[model samples]
Target: MRNPQRLNVPIQLDRDLPEPLHDQLAAQLRRAIARGQLAGRMPSTRTLAGVLGISRGVALAAYEVLLAEGRITGRHGSGTYVSGTGSAPVGAGSLPVRASDVVVDLRSDRPSTQAFPLAAWRAAWRRASHQAPPVEEPPPAGLPALRAAVAAYLRESRGLVLDGHEVVVTAGYADALALILRARHGAGRALIALEDPAPPALRHALARLGTVLPLPTDASGARPDLVPAGCDVVAVLPERGVLGARMPTERRRALAAWARESGGLVLEPAFDGLFNPSLTPRPSVLALGDADSTAMVGSFCDLLTPTLRLSFAVVPRRPAGAVEEGLHGQPSVTCQLAVADLLASGCVARRAERLSVLYGAKRAFVRQVLGAYPDTRLLGGDTGAAAALLLPAAVRAESVVGALLARRVRVADLAAFCHESGVRENGIAFSYGHLDAGLLSGALHALTGTLDDHRLPRRSAA
Candidate 1:
């Protein structure tokens, strides 16, 4: 067949940006390739390089990433071409590309729907349906049976011994947190300290409740000594999601002591223990600190699925109860009861075990790929569904993130997590919690490609 006319794919390179020139080239080419603009054959490295005013090595690097991702291929000498069959031509007559259609999200908050134990969940719901339905509005604190079950699950899974009455169910972490702040401070503004590099969404949510002081942190997670005087509450993620920081026993001890000495409340978002039969979690700050001065928020989103939005708060015993005096969003009794049954029947535990193995494999892939890169370091590995990589100083996390996102792989810069804008960091975070193994692998490779784009282009020895 005669070669199709060489297409005019608009490839722009801006050198002023922190994102590398090769990365910029790769992103535009990938976009064109996906649209079949480079359907049958692509320009040779030297030709494209000369045309674009970039080095041959730069063109070669872009091609290598696309090749690894199998988006394009090379014959013995015929140049690179799109790999898949039935690729549509770019431009008019072609379907318009929707933003949502092409994004491969790397944010790791949601778990896999396929991995959720559907059979067991359905069975639990069926059992819940068998029980007599409540005529009155269910208690905002949760159904008595569920509270008992939550307390039992906590004791079994987290080693935190508590009474059924102490577990107050809410719609999820947001509700649980809102209720906690209102109950303790009664809707009045209070001083709140949040971990530095906390999720921007969380910071916004807490901002309305009180002044949010950004608490600086290191590899060990949030610094306890920096809690600031008159701070009413300190929020920490024991799992330390994206930062990949694990609070050591000493750090936990120091936090517990801070809460004790200051009589301040410590808010810990506690995911349940690693479901692996062999692995039990270490003590939580809530478990180690004065229980009356600490509360641990728990969510089932990761344990089951975020769709089942039931979450609970293990309130400090000193409070008579977690009073949601004005709150109306307690989760449906059916969800609460069904999850309770899932826990009691060990369905949640079994699901945890399966997920442990699955996520372990995915996390290891992240470790092997991003971690193997000479200058990239993985952080906060022990507790959360998320993992963060600390990139070398030469590469800006924001630049790498932007370049990858342009290539259609959506990953986050640590700067994006800041409450205020324009903070720079050398770290980026992605999830192993609920993402597919394949999607996670591809995103990491694209990340590697973007990082490699920063290297000085190799020139011909001849």
Candidate 2:
């Protein structure tokens, strides 16, 4: 087939240009699309790369930026084409700007939907369906086999020892948190502490039932002193270590000690636990010396398919009865069955291993690109999954976020995560796992450009 006239894009790369070749290509393409210069069908990555005298990877990276932005769409076996208009392209703008619009979301906590192992999942589902039991009801807690597999996997990977019966499966992390809250604090209003800059969904979920307090963190993990005296339930991200320093052993011990003294329950939401490749694996609070007050919970949504709403919480033996009683009223038959098959097929384990490496590479790439902005600092860079860029205090985070959105770069501001006065920080969180190098570079360039264009001059210098 002949190339479409409108799809004939000429990307000029200057050797002297400080920007990377892939980023330059991506930015130019974005400009073309915005100006209606490149319309309808687009060229294949190979053709575009060959025409522009660049590597296929470079061309592909550029294409990924467009894809991430929803400027283009891929047809199986066919070439890429310009996406239809009406809704703004993905990453076209920040969250608030595109509040009602379905933008291609780069700020999502979930893994990239495109990279999901659909074939493996489908095969597993088919096999499980054929081997379906006479009854449609899920196993009491979950499919026993799946629970056992999860236990084994966690033991091997995360070093958490658990019996299959101890693992209670739920719809997702949200549901699991709800169940845990209900189990631990039935009718009583407990003071719950969470990270200051936490995932908004978590804050909303916890706020609905209890007095949610935002716990502050510096280079170390959540400060044990910051955890209010009256609070009995503290929710924390287990590995929120700063740049070079891991969460100190002393700090963890201190937190445990505090929990012990206060009679508080420590709920560790181990988000993206599987993706870390550090030599000394970050231990879960639940794994610390058989503490009866701590429970470790993990969600497969961020690591696997978000649509597959299966999460597990390793409850302390003390709370087992409470958890069981709380979950008795909820119906989760289909969810358990699907999760069981997913575990039995070994697809989750395999994919998780692969994604760990994939996300690590993407995280490194994003850091390399975003590192160009001297004024910006990356939070959680050592963790190799999600990082937040801390902008200068003078910069308007919300406006900058909106500007990025207009350019199709989706990101979340720290303001959304803050609670009460004197806790505001000028920053935004970026999930590197969901984005590739090319898209990341392009987005960074656009974001920096927007910030530069709008940033106020230093008052001292002025």
Report the number of the highest-TM-score candidate: 2
lDDT of each residue in 1-462, candidate 2, tens digit only: 233244555557776854457657776776566555665567778777666677898878777767766878887866677666323333444222222232435576657433455557666666666654645556446667767777777776677776422777765676677666776788676689886666777789888768898788777757778887689788776565312224666777777777778888888765544466654665666766345678767777766656666777677554334555555432355455556667666777777766777667766776666666667777676664677778887777897889888877788887776776427778887665665444566666776678668753322322
* Native-to-model Cα distance after best TM-score fit, residue 394 in candidate 2, in Å: 2.5
lDDT by residue (370-451, candidate 1, tens digit) is: 6546667777554445777777787788787888888788777777776463245677887656444445666676777887
Task: List per-candidate RMSD values in Å.
Answer: 13.3, 7.4
Which numbered prediction scores highest in lDDT against the true structure?
1
Off by over 4 Å in 2: 1-104, 132-136, 163-165, 241-246, 289-291, 318-322, 328-335, 455-462
Question: Would you estimate the TM-scores of all the predictions?
Answer: 0.73, 0.74
For candidate 1, the per-residue lDDT at 262 reads 86
What TM value does model 2 have? 0.74
